[model samples]
Target chain A: MKNYLENINKAFESRARLGIMSVLMVEEKVDFNTLKDTLQLTDGNLASHLRALEEAEYLRVEKQFVGRKPQTTYYASPAGREAFKSHLDALEQLILNNRQKD
Target chain B: MKNYLENINKAFESRARLGIMSVLMVEEKVDFNTLKDTLQLTDGNLASHLRALEEAEYLRVEKQFVGRKPQTTYYASPAGREAFKSHLDALEQLILNNRQKD
Candidate 1:
């Protein structure tokens, strides 16, 4: 019997991190303010989750200037996208497998 | 914006507990030994995860004897089923929302 649970990644366990990845998965790039607003997270709280994902090498960050203001943006790296897809696939499997029994 | 991430329960964050719930959701009653084998979890590991779910009122346990051996069986509480369904729905929403953008 295959253990589908093994495919659930701990890195994406937190809702905050999950939200970040969910947004990044679809959008090519999301700025700090946009992400913070979308997820409705405090600066500190969002920053911490972003740092955790970055440390896991699941996301890449970019800093640049928009006009006179400094802006930070995030992107889902190839590795991150691959891992997130696998995690999603595992969740789908868990749900589908149970549904079949019902 | 309705944050689908908000529907993701912290209780199901651990893969072990998730596996336990996934199994319990479908099966009416599962013995401790059967759960341990299905999830490929050690006794201590499975016990701890079971305790966590029990604490959350997500699962119910019944203990009795069959022949000369003591047997423990588990069932997913109504709350557990509801919570797990919400989590699965949130994951499905996340995946579907992103897919539409592709």
Candidate 2:
């Protein structure tokens, strides 16, 4: 159990962060507005969680301008992708362990 | 994603709590000492988490004495089992979503 739990990343514990990563997992790149709308998070809430993931190096941020407007985009880093995958694997193991007990 | 993430119980957000629930999901009843040792948590740490789970009504505690020594045991309440099952289902859905994306 410890072995299985160890891989579950604390970074993705927040549902917002989990939602962010889940989106990034399927999409190559997501802009700030798209993510905010998809996760239904306010700007501040989304920024903070995104910053947390960036600090963990699980996510990378790119700021660019589309015409006159500055747009921020997020991408799950290589490390982040690996870590999230391990976390999901751990979750799967825990679920499987329960079923086997049944 | 929102639908899947919504079912993850906040009570199991902590790794310690997750470990405790995972153990209880498999075993009918576990004593305090065994839970503490199995999760490798300090007495206070384990007690605090146990208290949180108890407050959430996810666990029921039974106390008695073996000779002069006191014993405390834990069992996952029926509600807890259902909640945890739902949480695990949400996790499985998240994992499957990722896999399907791949």
Each model's TM-score for chain A is: 0.92, 0.95
Query: Candidate 2 on B28-65: residue-level lDDT in tens?
Result: 99999999989999999999999999999999999999
Worst 10 residues of 1 chain A by lDDT: A1-10
TM, every model:
0.88, 0.93
Per-candidate clashes come to: 0, 0
Query: Which candidate number has the best DockQ?
Result: 2
DockQ, Cα level, model 2: 0.70
DockQ of each: 0.58, 0.70
Clash total of candidate 2: 0
Q: Write the per-residue lDDT of candidate 2 for residues A16-56, one digit (tens) a residue.
A: 88799999998999999999989889999999999999999
Interface RMSD over true interface Cα atoms for each candidate: 2.1, 1.2
What lDDT does the true structure give each of the candidates? 0.87, 0.90
Candidate 1 per-residue lDDT, tens place, A1-102, comes to 246788989888777877898889889999999999999899999999999889989999999998999999999999999998888788778778767876
Fnat for the candidates in order: 0.57, 0.62
